[model samples]
Target chain A: MGEGLRGSIETTGLTMIYRSGKVEVPAIREINLTVGPGEFVAIMGPSGCGKSTLLHLLGGLVRPTRGQVLIDGIDIAKLSDAERTAVRREKVGYIFQRFNLLPNISARANIELAKRIHGNGHANLYKDDHILALLGIKEKIGFRPTELSGGEQQRVAIARAVINQPSILLADEPTGNLDSHNSRLVLTLLQDLNQRLGQTIVMITHDSEAASMANHVIEMRDGRILARTHHFVYEPEFEGLF
Target chain B: MTHSLVAANILSRPTRTLISILAVGTGVILMLIIGGITTGTLNDYLNRTMSVGADFILQPSGSTVFYAFSSAALPIKLADKLRETPGVGAVAPVLAKFSSADFGLVFGIDLATYDQFPGRLEILEGRNSLQGNEVIVDDLYAMSHKVSPGMTVEILGRKFTISAICRRGSVVRVFVPLPTLQQMNGTEDKVTIMFIKAAPGADVESVFRELHRAYPGLALVRTTDPSVLLADTRMPGLKEFRLTVVTVSMLISFMVILLAMYTTIFERTREIGILKSMGASKAFIVGLILRESVIISLLGIAFGVGASLIIRKLITTAFPTLQVDMTFVEVLRGSLLGLLGGTLGALYPAYKAARMDPVQALSYE
Candidate 1:
């Protein structure tokens, strides 16, 4: 496999509806969007705008009523559940808003879990140390989720998510529970990962300030894309500067 | 993940683990106790029934009825003919009576020939042979009746001296000379049974066949055979009662195991879901749960067997003559039975846990 090669994501006529009793509420309606390889995209909208629903649909976490989600030229919607899980394991990295680390395991074990799940043989050989050093959490490897600060825990979560080195990283308000200082730190890490590693990042956030950190921004309202913005890319001069 | 981790996971919840172990332990203990009692009592009954020193029992043809109530009589001449046959060592005629009034048995034996049989009697007091107007009562009966070696006792309105007190077959017995018994009962010519012994290397089957051929009306039986030992023996109702008791105990053990396994699965619903989400196949999840259950069951079985053995030892010590033998094979059999019962009990819960979906499991509060 080629290192630091990003994968593109595309959705066509994606429609999703939530049904409870006799009521049918549309979450995402006939939406079409595309993100190029190595592109950092952000979805921004108000509450109940189906931003998370669209992200879930694109990630194959939820089945769309009628649509196609293509990742790296293959329509993931056509894959079986087991096959979809395999694709997610091999190609997609998910960072949940809640930082869903298994509470019983230590920080290093949490990161090791991802590698083990992907059948990586070298999971135990300095991989935890490397990820922790990259995230500046080398000392917190032995700590469990309860013992870490919000920022440190989210960093551990991010390390766990990216341990497999997936082609696409999906973040659902990764900084929702952090302070501004931690939020900036997490956002800068995401941006740095996308630039240096060329890992495609698709983030969903309600805050415009958070969305401004991305290279592209898409606005959604009532299950539809209200607007899209493409920002100018600024290539940093120094490489390996950390 | 790893075997060590799986073991740690199973043992992490101390309370749940202990409860599961206790469930298995309880079942094993109950099985051990019931099995011990059944084997102990059955053996005791057999020893007692065979206590008449009868190496070979001769009854009527096809007269394998196992209750003492069967009054089937064998011809007295069969004993004389068996003594005349080749390889014949000794023979004795016995007249067995079941008296509801005394709630015991009275055997009319010839003291002259009873000495040839092993474990014939342990005379506790007084003379060995039954003299004129005298009888030998069992030690238990003598103790219960406060009768000593020379005391005169009345039986069925006939007075006789207690010539000796003896113990045989774990029961309260009384022995009178055949002539006196026949004179008192007015059955001088009839004989209820015959006990025979053969010389070393004599084929018992051939002798049995010859005896049957000689006296076609007499049914030759071996004391060791389960069918023959049970024939014309009292306590069929007691055997049936013991069987019912054992069956009910097993059913209770099964139910206990089922309930415990079901609760264990129910409590681990979220953990199962997590494993499934971690790419664990349904079979893997099921295997893990089953491993956990079997571990708990085996632990319980071990504890139960130990406890039952202790109890059995205590009982045996408390009553020296009451034999309690629990072989290793019996314990192994009991443990395997427990394992099978535990696995059967856990099948439904294992299936339920395996069928759980990851998304739904993670969503559970």
Candidate 2:
């Protein structure tokens, strides 16, 4: 996104079936979707609607039972676990609902883990501090995760997710564990990141308030997409938005 | 950053990590000192015997070099015959006796003949004469017993005056007249051993051959080489003792490291899941765990080496005859083995953590 690099993502006939002791449970039905480069999409659904599973498939966390997922025009569903892991490290950055920060390390260390996994050694690059300051978490870098509040921890997780400047970010319930004040704050930060960096973001949420912040809101029910609605929140600074 | 990432997790549980280190250290110390003293004492005795400058030792057949187990009363006439043999320069008869009270061996010898060798007894603090009812004690024995010259002491239930404090490292710490010891033991014409020296500029091999031929029933042992003395088949259980010590020591490190790392992986399941979700490879996770283990092992090895050195010093002070060899090579062998055992013990746990399913691990409460 920084250099208008490719960020196109697509899935065809995505299907998932869970088997437990010979009992078949269909978690996802056939679905086809495409996201243009630099698009900000929010998926809204009820519990057990397979939104999380879809996010996992997009991130190459699990193999799809049927169908293929393509990131930047490369089909990740055809890759092995190790290959998919490599793709995830280089291309997709995931933010979880729980904000999985390593408790034993400082906030900076939690964010730096992403850079280390990206094989950046300990250099931190030229943009790491800039991203932390952009997220308003530069002051809490020295504090351990346990010393930080829930909202602060989630902000650190966000910083970690985008530190590598990945092409795509797949977030599951980014605001599910936060209060209204913190939820709005996190949503505003996500929107700011999307508009300022032209980064592709696919976030899952249950609140309509959170969904309204995205350029496009997708409604899902019973493992299928029910509707696709555009918000049309056009800002002059985001003129080249996809 | 990677170093601190692994170190922070280990430092978080200081008690568990320290216990693991101490357990490994204790194992290494046990292996080095225990195995060292066994061979140390044996080599020390052999070296002292070689220092006597005796070309060969004549003893009863199949007798151990140590006199405690041997009371073979060979005729004192063996010395005159050994002296008459060609290539023999001097022959001194020794009536060896073990004094349980002093934990030392007492040698009864004729001063004129004993002084003919290169390692003649040198009295450090008193007159070197050995007359009726006179005894000579080495420096260590004199210092430990607090007995000086002219102090009458009861040895073998008989009273005798301490006439001299001789230099240490001699074949025996206490010495008296040969006839006096032989008369007291009721063996008037018998001696335990004879120290024979080859004539200067004579062929030692020829002297040994003539001695062996003349004393076929007696044990003629060459004292010039330590390996020859150590190669005696009568030294029972030395190898087995060393092996047992090494096995027990390695087992301690192996079991402690295995249990500690096995428990560590179980406790950090969620952390493993997070690392995996962050796109860390199996090799990366394994490397992290091994790095922490290596640090712990190095610390343990340092502590073990230091403690062994101190313990060796203490042992030598407490018992002068006991030697504890802690050469650099031996210490290196011990530390390396300790590290190897600890590293091997962590392999299974590291593999298990690498193979964990990220989803399952993350969901693990």
lDDT value, candidate 1, whole model: 0.72
lDDT by residue (tens digit), candidate 2, B1-365: 67778899789899989998898899889988997887687776787777788999888987777855578478998788888899999988988888888766788899889999888898899898887899998888888778899999878778989999999888878899888998888888999888899999889999999989987998899999777777747576777887788888888888888888889999999889888888888888899888888888888888888889888988889877677888788898899888988888888899999888887787778
DockQ of 2: 0.57
- When just chain B is superposed on the true chain B, each candidate scores a TM-score of 0.73, 0.89
Q: What is the TM-score of chain A alone in each candidate?
A: 0.90, 0.92
Candidate 2 Cα outliers beyond 4 Å, as residue runs: A1-6, A13-26, A29-31, A73-78, A122-124, A221-242, B58-77, B93-112, B126-135, B150-163, B176-193, B212-221, B232-236
lDDT against the true structure, each candidate = 0.72, 0.85
**For model 1, how does the per-residue alpha-carbon lDDT over A78-143 read when each residue is reduced to its tens digit?**
887667667776777777677766665677776666676676637665765666677888899788
